[model samples]
Target chain A: MAKKKSESSVSTVPSPASSRAAGVAPSHTDLLRQMLLIRRFEERCAEAYALGKIGGFCHLYIGQEAVGVGAISALRADDYVISSYRDHGQALARGIPPRTIMAELFGRVDGCSKGKGGSMHLFDRNINFLGGHGIVGGHIPLATGVGFAIKYRGGDQVCLCFFGEAAVNNGAFHEALNMAALWKLPVIYLIENNRYGMGTALERASAINDIAERACSYDMPNEVVDGQDVLAVRDAVLRATQRARGEHTPTLLEVRTYRFMGHSMSDAASGTYRTKEELEEYMKRDPIIVLRTTMEKNGEWSDTAMTALDEELKAVAQDAWDFADASAEPAVEALTEDVYVW
Target chain B: MPVVTYRDALNQALQEEMQRDDRVFLMGEEVGVYQGAYKVSKGLLQEFGEMRVVDTPITELGFAGVGVGAAMVGLRPIIEFMTWNFALLAMDQVVNSAAKMLYMSGGQFNIPIVFRGPNGAALQLSAQHSQAWESWLAHIPGLKVVAPGTPYDAKGLLKSAVRDDNPVIVLEGEMLYNTKGEVPAEEYLIPIGKAALKREGEHCSIITHGKMILVALQAADQLTKEGIRVDVLDLLSLRPMDVEAITASVRKTNRAVVLEEGWEIGGIGAQVVDYIQRECFDDLDAPIVRVHQVDVPMPYAKNLERAAKPDVPKTIAAVKKVMYLDQ
Candidate 1:
């Protein structure tokens, strides 16, 4: 089919006054750049996976970039961020260096986890990125505990926990939310409703399709936002974070998004479970394209600027791959190390 | 020195640790207003208030993960599982999350937490509630397992566990809770991975821990009356397995009899036998013997429960058999 006229008009140029009135200064451009960086980074990762440079389970964040980049933009440096296995974007959005994350995926000594945790487990304690836990909903409880620790220490800092939409069915999700609500812990449970958990669609897996409504049982404030829109997610998460920091209230946020690629590199991007039409439909609202169009239409950005930015980000992603390729494998003696502190 | 029951000793250790460190807090079912199911945390809620002394819901996996998360961020959380049997619900958190976080994070995180609760059978509590899990926990590499047999060891080990910068599992003996022993009022900490020799003898050694230590001692007493002097070695720590102490005692006695309240398969006794046979193989004058609970679920009937567990008679029989005595 054909592209709609309205979709083209949405990218029409805007006046300088309108851009200023929208307050699209540091954010709109920055969010676009970050989302582009993640897109390019994940594209290179898929190539690296095919080349056998990166091993283990590699879950890409191709389409859900806006959810991670947007929500993380609202967080402070001192606040904590935890997410599920598809965390390359979240880690990059949380400001973790691309080189370190790439090296981790390469299983090299310079990796953040020193080659111990492969792609599925990326961690940087310095930035308070707890980890990229592999288990479906295992980290929910841990995130609640992080909120508990912050509250116990009398800190206004909030923790943002990201998981797949399917995690709502996990007992840990319910138990952790109940505890967070009962204790009034400062935590925001962000669900990246990416339509499918691996191959199972959300509707087939969840009895209640509206995940945000499930939080009401625990008396938590919640919202469902357009995850493909970076600004929308950023605004919603900012409001929730403010409430968490101000009143020590926990919020459940369900970001309605879709993945462009299959679950992982192992999955064939075919129409076995999902229809080709569904992929094409969601591709129309690609987060990077949407954000770039919005910025370009507002006159805050240009085609030449984005083209130059894309080249720069491609170099950055390439530099990460080069650094990972040149890095040394962990020493044999290091195998037994880090098992225990003592 | 002050004479206190094992339960009071644990309570004192928690109170002292919480008083000493502001980051140390307690959370579990019935640990606050209910004062603990076994009253092990008696009077703590009144002193520390609800924040430090938390009363968690019956969601073991949730709170246990919370304790791990809290520990990750430098809060020393003492997560009490009502019993080791109930801890099965949270094994994912205990074994998978807490035990593997440090290694998985490449030494970035140190889980400075303690999972404490009464372990093993306690007077015919039936199958579900009556199970020992020391061996199961000790199998994990990143965890430190400590079982205190007496009031003095209980207080000392617990204090050390709280201060240790790693995940420690303190398995208290339910049957030994009311048993009293002399505990010093002065600040003391019994180093972990060290065993205490309760009674020294020349004929054979009775190596045990937890409630079985008392049974071993009683068996030693009975063996003394029958002219068989058996050494009683109490292995307070299971994971680190006080190999030096076990080897030294086995070398001296030239024979060993291991005792445990868990099943025969993969019990602490099995570990001891492996260690003794490997290290003290040539030093042994006779084959090492193991006395453990019968290989079956603990029955509710009083007589069957007594027959199912490792008692003084079983210990005495093992010691006598290792000494080459008939009957």
Candidate 2:
């Protein structure tokens, strides 16, 4: 690997705010822009899936956009993030282009993963967005080990692992948390407690109910945050990120939120476990609405400006879809490709 | 030629591979300071330190997932399951995560890892710890399953597995750990998907793997003394099974018997029979006979446990049945 002068000096992140939670704070406009991007990107994904443009299992982050936007907004570019299948928002928030993501959903040759990984499988090493793991609680240990890599390499990088509240009951969750806490690895376990685990209500499914409380068994600091509030979620993640890098301790955060969409494309949102009214009730506290109301109250954004921003994002999303739609399918020869060193 | 036990050959392979490449390391329950309950990873922690040769907490899913991640990030890891029976706990990580990473990642990540340990019944280890999991693992497409019976294949295949660019499950025989055999004194790698011929003959073919290969070989020798020639073929790699080798041998011998130490019901032998029937059914003079372990929970008594699994007598009986020796 050659380290040329141009390549070495070329920083991975453009905005200084993309690095640490340093003195270079992001403007309100930048915050709103990134948040809107994630929201619109996921909305387009859902629509594309409905149009039969996307294939495989698709888990949309429709109502839970702020969880990824706020959490990722608080970290440095060097910090790694490992999340579960509902990761379109995280990928968009982490600066992966909507075009590449859309192409991936379309299984196109131009996709980020070259049509190999569909909805549930996404990876971008350059941005350090590890993957959209299909298996429940599978990537928890991997995130812990990534934190170990940072510490081993003698860097201050932290790893933020995100999983649904359902993963808390898995054996891997317990095993990974114990190891991370025991090693004092710089990792933060974020639980997006959306009150439902694939049609099963959290209250009925989990005996403990409070996922954060599970972290106390490992003697790790646990925090519960309202995931719909962007600033609050950002503040909580920033605090945990600081503790992880500074004190060398792992923290578990229970982000109280809800998903408007079903577990996957095949799942119908309206079902026996949850009512339409419950879904509508969660929509009232939607992360996008919370951010928009906050910005309106502070006079940081106006309805006219918001409308214009929405129009711009709509154009971008439309362009992304068109770009993905026009992209060629992978070659027939590619079917037997990438299995091994062949 | 150097004489080494099957267990020592595996340990030497791990040590040599770890020394040859910094990326290679071992992680399991007591692989580190505990020196492995089986004592296969003895002196590893002292030699490689806690960073490389790690003693993970009793967390099979966690450590296996960690190994998958490490492999994704350019490290070759050998995850030990004290026994393959315990791997049931980490099945998701092995089957869903490690096996599917390359395909799932759209080819961005290839997990060059090996999950190795003892697999079948050795003593009265009983139901929980004595069952063979090769059939279950071989069911998945993205995985490569290897079961080496001899010290030479154990060392060579392990070295190849450590360096190969895919996930492999190396199922070693627990009872054969102390069995000594001659091994070469140079670095060699037996490629995956290659079968080895333990003995050559023309009358009938015996296809088996792992510890069953020894049993089959003994049966072949006994039959040879009785003036009946038997070709003994060791199907080391179970997934990309040496179907061509077995088919070619059966086409020549015109009769075949599949032997396995696992349960007869839906075992690796059943899979081989299906493959052989599809590939060389026309060449068969007699129906393919499969000698497999009795399908039942291995009892806690030594005699019952030995009786439950396929043995030399069972192999000889199956061969005799195929050869029409009763007449």
Using all chains and alpha carbons, the TM-scores for the candidates as numbered come to 0.95, 0.93
- Give the clashing residue pairs of candidate 2, or none: none
lDDT of 2 at B1: 96
- lDDT per residue as tens, model 2, A1-342: 111223222222233235344645555566677677767767778788888889778998888877887898888877888889888888877777777888989999888778888776778877777888887888898888777666555678888889999999988899998988887889999999999899888988788977799998999999999998878888999999999999879999999999888888788887678889988888999887888788778888787887766666666667678778999999999887777664
**Which candidate leads the pack in lDDT?**
1
- Candidate models: Cα lDDT each: 0.89, 0.84
For model 1, residues A4-62, the per-residue Cα lDDT tens digits are 22323322323222332344543687788788889988898999999999988999999
The candidate maximizing DockQ is 1
- DockQ, per model, reads 0.74, 0.57
The 10-residue segment of model 2 chain A with minimum total lDDT is A1-10
Q: What's the number of clashes in each of the models?
A: 0, 0
Put down candidate 1 lDDT per residue, B218-261, tens digits, no spaces.
88888889989888999999978899999999989999999998
In terms of TM-score, the best-performing candidate is 1
Runs in model 2 deviating more than 4 A are A1-24, A265-281
Place model 1 in a CAPRI quality band. Answer: medium
